[model samples]
Target: MDKHIWEEFVELERNPKQIERCEKNAEYRSMQTIRHTLGRCSYSNKQYKLDEESNVKVVPKATTDKWLMGHQRPDGSVHPSAIEAHKKVLEAKEKNKGKGLSSDDHLVSPELEEVFPCKRKDIIRGYSSTMSKKQCEMAAVASAALQNRDTDHEERMQAIESTMGIVVGKMASFQTLLGMLGGKVDSVIQMMIANAAAQGPISTPSPEKGSTTYPAGVHSRVMETEDSAPCTLDVGQPVQLLDNVGKVVALGSIVAGVTVHGRKVKPNERKVYIEQVYDQKALVWDAPQGDGYVVLSQLSLPTWLIWAEDRLVGLLNS
Candidate 1:
C-alpha cells in the first residue's frame, strides 16, 4: 500500500512542467510544495535548508513505520501482519475441523506461523470480549430499555448491533467524503492559482499570522530524519504534512492539518480544519473533524493535480 501510494505521489513529478512553474516563484512556501508532494514536511529539517529535507525514499514502507505493527490498545499489541495471519490461521483451522490435515494444514502463511503459530491455542489471544466501558454501559441501558419494551435478549442485542452498525457506517462514509472533499478543495485552490498565473504572477501575501522560520543555513539533517520537530498544529491554521504514512494511517490512504499561530500540531489534537496556505479561508465540511482531510499548499497544487487526477478523483465515493 505504501509503495503504491509513493508511486501515486511520484507520478506528479513525471510532468516536469508543473514543477517548472513553481520554480518561477521559488519562494520558500512555493518550494515547500515540491517537498509536500514528495511527502516531506517542515520542522523535520528545521536547521537544514529545503534541499536537505528528508524523503520517504519512495520505497516499500518499512515494517517499523507501518502503524499497525505493535498496535497497543488496552487489550494488547500485535505485529503489522499478525492480524491477517491470525485470521487466515483461524479460517484454516475451522475449515479443516473434521478432515485429516495434509497439505491443507499448511494453509497458514508460513512466515506468519513461525511467529503466531497455526493452532488457536498457540495464537496470540487478546481479543476483547467486551467493548469499552462506556459502550458497555450504553449497551446495558439499551438492554434495559428493550426489556421494558418486551423484546427478548437476542432481539435487543440485534437491535443495538444493527443500529450501531448503521451509525458507524455513516461515520465512515462521512470520513471518506472528507478525504475526497479535501482533494476537491485543493483542486479548486489550484485552479484559482493557475488562473491567476495565466494572467500574471500570483503574489504570495505575507503570512497573515507569522509562520515558523528556518534558522541558519542547511538545518540539521538529524531533525529531518528524526520526527522530533518542535512544532504544534492547531485549529483553523494551515499545516504541511511531514510524513505521507500519517495520512495513510489516519485517513486510511487519506490525502490529508493545525491552527493558533497557524503552525505546529497541538499535543493529542488530531483533527483540524484544513486551510489553503495561500488563501485567507474557505468553507468545506462545515468544520473539519478528522485527519482524512488534506489541504495542499498552493505551490504543490499543479504537480499534485497530475497525481490527483491519476488517482481517478471522479471514481472516489460521492
Candidate 2:
C-alpha cells in the first residue's frame, strides 16, 4: 500500500498539469487523489473503478466529507476556509511578484511627491525594498524638493504679510499727515478771506470766462451759475475744516431763531448760513465734528484718494 501511494505521488509530481491543479485548488487535488486510490481498490480479484468518462463524477455523500477535509498544517489541524484564503493570498503574491508596483499598491513615485506629499512610511518602505539604488536616490531627491517647496511657500506668505502691514501703516500715516496739513490750510484760507473782506470789496481779478479750470492747490471745484446760489453738499464729501467726511441728510434754508446743532457744538456757539441769506459772511470753522451741515464751498474731495466709495462698492459686489 505504501509503495502504491509513493508511486501515485511520484506520478503526480511528474505531471506538471496535476501539480499546477494541486497548487491552484488543493481540495480538488485531494478529491482527485482519493478517487485514484478508490480506483486501485480490488474486490473479488476485480478492480472497483469509478467512471473515467466524466471529469466531475458525484461521490457518495459520506465519502465527500472525508475527501474534502483539506490538507493538515504542521500542527495537524485542518481549516478549509483558512487554507483557501491563504492560497488566494499566495496566488496574489505570485501574480504580482515579478511585476512592478500595482495601482492598488498606492506606491508613492518620485513625481507624485510634488502633489501628494503625505505618503505612508510603510508604503514607501515597501516600494523602496524592491527599488534599485538609482531609484532610491531619485525618491530622496523628490522628497527634498517637496520639503523645499513647502518651506518656500511658507516664507513667501510671511513676506507678503509683512510687506502688506508696512504698506498699510505708511498709508495710514500719510492720511493723518494730509489731514493735519488740510486743517492748517483751512485756517490760512479763513484768515485771507477775513482780510479781503475788511479791505472793502477790493477789486479781485476774475477767473477766465467760461473756464471750468480749478486752482492747483484746491482739491475740487464746482462752478455755479449765481454767486448767491445755495451750495449743496453731497454725502461722503469731506469738509475742508473737519477731520472727517459728512453725509447730507436734508436740504432747506435754516429758519430764523432755529439753532443749528452738531456733535461737538457748544450751546449757541455755532451757526450755519447760505451766502444768499447771510449777507455773504463766512462763519468760523471747527474740526473733528460729526454729521453737520456745511456749505459746498467748504468741502474738498481729494483727487487721489485710495479705497474710495466706488472701489469699495465694486469690491463688495464682486
Candidate 3:
C-alpha cells in the first residue's frame, strides 16, 4: 500500500501542471485559518497576531491579516521599535542642548590652521556674506580639519609604501645571494662527478636512502621538469584549489577527482588537473578553477613557492 501511494506521488510529481496545482491547493489550505483572525504589521509587512494571552506575536502569512491594526486605514506611524529609538534620540538632544561645543565641534587647532591656511573669503562665499559668526567659524574649522586629515592620510600612506619598499629590497637581495650559492655548489658537485668518472669506474658514496641533499636546487629542478611533463595527478596529493586547499581523492581518464575548499566533488563533473605533488600540503600553485577544472598551461608558480623552497633549503642545510 505504501509503495502504491509512493508510485502515485511520483506520477503526480512527473506532471508539472498537476504538481503546481497541488502546491497551490496546499498553500490555500494553509492560509485559510490565518486569513480569519491575525493581521500584518503596516511598517514591516510581517504578519502579527493577538494570541489568546492578549500579547502580540509574529506569525507566518497563513496566520495573520493584511494589517496589524484592525482599522481600515493605516495612520502612517512608525513601528514601536522605531518610535522608541526616535524618543531616545530626542531625549539625548534635549540633554546635550545646554552643553557647550564638544571636542568634535571645536575649530581646527592653531598649528593646523597655519598648515591649512583657511581663506575667510572662501568660507563666506561658500554660504553667504551674511552668514552668522558661528556658522562661519564652523565652516572654516571643518575646511581646515578636512585638509589636515587628507594631509595626514597621505603621509601615512607614503610611510607604509617606503617601509614595504625597504622590505622588498632586502628580500630580493637575499634571494639573489641564495641563487648564486646554489649555482656554485651545483657546479662544484658536477665537476667532482666528472673527475671521478675520468678516474675509471670509481664508485661514489651516495647519501642515505631516505636522506636528501641540496633540496632547494632539487626542488627547482623538479619544478622545471614537472612544468614540461604531462599532468600526473593522483589521489591524496594536496592541490591548491580555486578557493581552498584540497587533496586529490579520485582519478579519472579525462577528469581528475578533487575536493575543493572542503566540498566533495560531485559525480559527472569535469576535473581539471593543476599539477602533481609529493607533499599533500605543498603550496606550489594558485587554486584551480572554482568548478575544479582549469587550463593546465595557463597556471604560474604560486607566490608561496619561493618561501617553501627557502624553508626546504634551511631544513636541508641544518
Candidate 4:
C-alpha cells in the first residue's frame, strides 16, 4: 500500500462507524505485515488440533475479510481447489496417498494483495474525496454494467463445471448444442483446428498475456506450457482472448469435428485433441468489438451463437 494511504488508514477519526473501520484497517495492516515480513501468519505460531506435525499458516474466518477471495496469491500459489492444490494440506500428499482426503482440507495460502482491499485502485476511487463528481459517476456506471456480466459468468461457469464433471467428461449438452446449429459453426471450427495443426507444438499461455486467467475455484483442465504464465488481468477488466486462446478454441473444434464425422466422440480422442491444442500458437482475434472474444464475423444464423468454453463469448448479428 502507498505511504499516504497507509497514513490515511491510520488517521480516520469520525463517528462510531469510522472509528470501527479504523480499528479493522489497523488490524488488517498488522496481519499483512506479519504475513510478508515473517513469511507466515501470526496464527501459525500455535499448535492446532488438526495438523500437529506441521505448523502451517491458517487464514481464519474473519468478518473483516469476508469478501477477500484468492486472486493475488495466484502467482505461483496453489489453487484452493482439491485438484490444483497439489501441495497437501497436511504434511505431504504423497505420504498419505489413497487416504481419500477431501479437497477443502488442504492447507492453501491466504490471498494477500500487496495493497489492502480498501486501498485498491477501483474500490478507493469511490471513497476518495479528491475525485471529481464525473469520475465517481463513471466508476459507479462501470460497476452497474458489470452486474449482468458477472451473473452470466457465474452461471456459465457453473454449467460448464457441472457438464465437464471431475476432469474432461463427455459434454453431451455441448454436443447437442452443436447439432442444434447444424452447419452454422463448422467452418469456423474447421479453420481453427487446421491452423492449430499447422503450427504443431508451441508454448501455452505466454507470459506477456501475466498469470492464469482461470479463477481460483476452477480446475484448469486446459494444458499449461512450461514457461507460459498468463497475464495478471485485474478483476472485471476485459479478458485478453487474443493471446494464448488456442486451447479453448481447440475444445470447441474437437466437439464440432465429431458432428461432421457422424460418430460419437471418444474419450481418448478428446484427450489427444486437448493436449495437442496448447502446443500450437493461437490465432484468437478479429472481432468487431476488438476485445478478442469469439463472436462470429458472419451472420449465417441470427438466432444461434458460437461460444468458446474457457474464454469470452460475444454475440454478433448483422
Candidate 5:
C-alpha cells in the first residue's frame, strides 16, 4: 500500500501486546457483564402499579402539579389524585382533537378564556366535578384574571404566578443561588481588606539578647504572682502551664524551633524541632520538652481557638 500505511503496520507490530491487552480487557469486561446478568437471573422480581389506594398515604400527581402551578389550596393540599388529573388531561385532549382548536391548544390559557378560550363544557368536565355552575364560572374568571391573555397554556400558568406575585425577578433559583452567595462572599472579602488597611502596617518585635528561638512544640509558662494576678479573690494554682490546662489545637511531628508569636528563640535546654503551632493567639517561649511539659494558654483566649477535634466537632454539631 502507501508508505504511511506500511509505517503504521510496522508500528502496530512493534506494540503487539497493546492489541492483546485491549482484547483481554474487553473479554474481562464482557465476563463481568455476563456474571451480573446471571446473578440478576437467579432472583425473581415483580413491579406493581401504584394505584389510588396508595394515593391516600402518598402524594399525588395533581397535588404536585398544583404546587408547580403556584396553587396552594386550603390545608396546604396538592392535587387530590393522579387519576383525576389524568382524566382532566384526557378530556382536554379529546375536546381539542380533530379541530382547528387542536392546532392552537398551545395558544390558549385560563386567562385568555375571554379571547382564545377552551370550550367551557371541556373546562367544566375536565375539572370541578363537585363544583356548581356559578362556582366554575367564578374559578374560570379568577384564572383568566391571573394569566396573561396572549400567553400559551404553559406560559399562562407561569404568568398567573407572576401576576399574583408568587415569584419575582429578584427571586433566587438553583442556578443563581451560587452567584448570590458569591456576591455576599465578595462583600465580606472587601470588608476584611478595608479593616486591614485601616489598621496600617504591622511591626515585628525584636528578640531580647541571649534569648533562644522557641521550638514549635515547646512552650514556657510563667505563673502570675500575687501582685500580677487578674484577680486574687478565687485562688487556684499559682504557677499554671497554659497548654496543660487548656486544649491542644494542633498535634504534628516537631520540625523546628520557633516562638508562638514568630520570635526567634535561641536553643537552651529546650528540644528544637519544626512542627505546626496551635495559632498566633498567645506567646510561646523556648522551653525544654520533657515528661509532663505541655503548652497552655489563658482561658480568656479567643472563642475561635479550639484545641481538640472532639471539642471542635461538638461545638459545630451543637
Candidate 6:
C-alpha cells in the first residue's frame, strides 16, 4: 500500500515544469505556499538562522520524517522529541513479547521510567496484571461506544475484532511510510543537478557588438554552481513540521526548482505553492468545560506542498 501511494506520488512529479509555474504565483508566494512546497515547517530553518546568524540549510523534515521509526504513543501518534525513547521501548517490547525478559532487554525498557504516577515498568514486569486486566476491560467498554454496523452483541464482538485489525493496519501503514521515505532525498538531489544544468555559459566580450576585452592579467570570475541548494529528508527522522500545531489535511506534488516558474525575489529566493492543504481553522481545546473546537483562520501553519520532489502538503480541512 505504501509503495502504491508513493508510486502515485512519483507519477505526479513527472512534469516538473508545470509544478514550477504553480509554485511561483503571487498567491502561492505566501508563507503558506512555501510550507506546502517544502512539506515541513515553513520557518524552522529561518528561526534557526535568526538565532545563530549563520547560513542554515533548509531541510524538508516533513511528515515523511515523522511517519518513520519514531516514538509512537500507545494510541499510535508520534511526537518529535519522544521518537528515540519510543523506538527503544518498542524494540524492547517486540523483543520480549511472549519470551521471558533478559538482562539485555533492560536497555530498551529502562527501570523506573515513569511518565504517569503509576509504574509502567512494573506493569511490564507483570507485577500489575490486575491493573492491566482492568485497563483492558475499560478499553473494551470504551470500544463499545464506537459506531459499528453490527447490531447484535455477538456481531459487535466481531466488529471489535475488525476495528482492532484496522488499528493494526494503520500502524503498519505508518511503518511503511517510513520505509519509502528515501525517495524524497533522491528528488531533492536531482533538483540540485537540474539547477546546475540551468547555469549555462557566461558570455565573452565580442569586438564590434561588445566592449573591449581586459588585459590578460585581469582576474576573471569562474562560473560556479547555482545559488539554490538541495536538502534531502531521511526516513524515521523526527523534525518539527509546523510552526503551529494543526492536523495535516491535504498533500500535493510541486516542481519549484530554480528553472521552474516560482516567484524569485532574488535569484535564490523562490517560493513554492501548496494547494488545499489547510483546514478552515486550527483545532484546539479550551477550558470552562474544556471543549474542543476549530478556530477559523487561526491556523498558524500553512498547507504542505512538496515543492521540489513528490512532497506531501498538509492542507486546511475545509
Taking all chains together, the TM-score of candidate 5 against the true structure is 0.17
Estimate the lDDT of model 1: 0.33
Higher-scoring candidate on TM-score, 1 or 2: 2
In candidate 3, what are the lDDT values of residues 123-231, reduced to their tens digit?
3111122232233233233333334456669999999999999999999999999887997889999999897677543221332212223322232232211112123
List candidate 2 segments past 4 Å from native. 1-131, 185-318
Instruction: State the lDDT of candidate 1 residue by residue for 1-318, as single tens digits.
Output: 576887867887676886886665465333221111112423223213322333322111222111122122223343342466435544654454546543323422332333334454443222121122222222223322323344355678999999999999999999999897997889999999887667652221323322223322312211222222123332222233322211110011112233322334443434422222333132112123223223332232212111111111011122
Candidate 2, 192-276: lDDT as tens digits: 9997677542221334322222333221222122232123323333212211222121112222222233233244332222222
Q: For candidate 3, which ten residues in a row score worst on lDDT?
A: 306-315
User: Which sections of candidate 3 miss by over 4 Å?
Assistant: 1-128, 185-318
Quote the RMSD, in angstroms, for model 4.
Answer: 32.2
**TM-scores, all models, native as reference:** 0.13, 0.20, 0.21, 0.15, 0.17, 0.13
- Cα lDDT of model 5 by residue, 1-318, tens digit: 576998888788678797897777676454321111212322112001112323331221231122123222323343353244444544554554544344222322332232223576644322323322233233322222234223346677887888767455546464488776888889999999998778653321222211223332232222212332221112121112234333334322212334423334343312122233454353333221222223424322321121211111011111
| lDDT values, one for every candidate | 0.33, 0.34, 0.36, 0.34, 0.34, 0.35
TM-score of 4: 0.15
Worst 10 residues of 2 by lDDT: 309-318
Model 6, runs deviating above 4 Å:
1-88, 97-133, 140-318
Candidate 4 residue 44 Cα shift, in angstroms, is 49
Worst window of 10 by summed lDDT in candidate 5: 309-318
Q: Which number leads on TM-score? A: 3
- Better model by TM-score, 3 or 6? 3
Estimate the TM-score for candidate 1: 0.13
Pairwise lDDT winner, candidates 4 and 6: 6
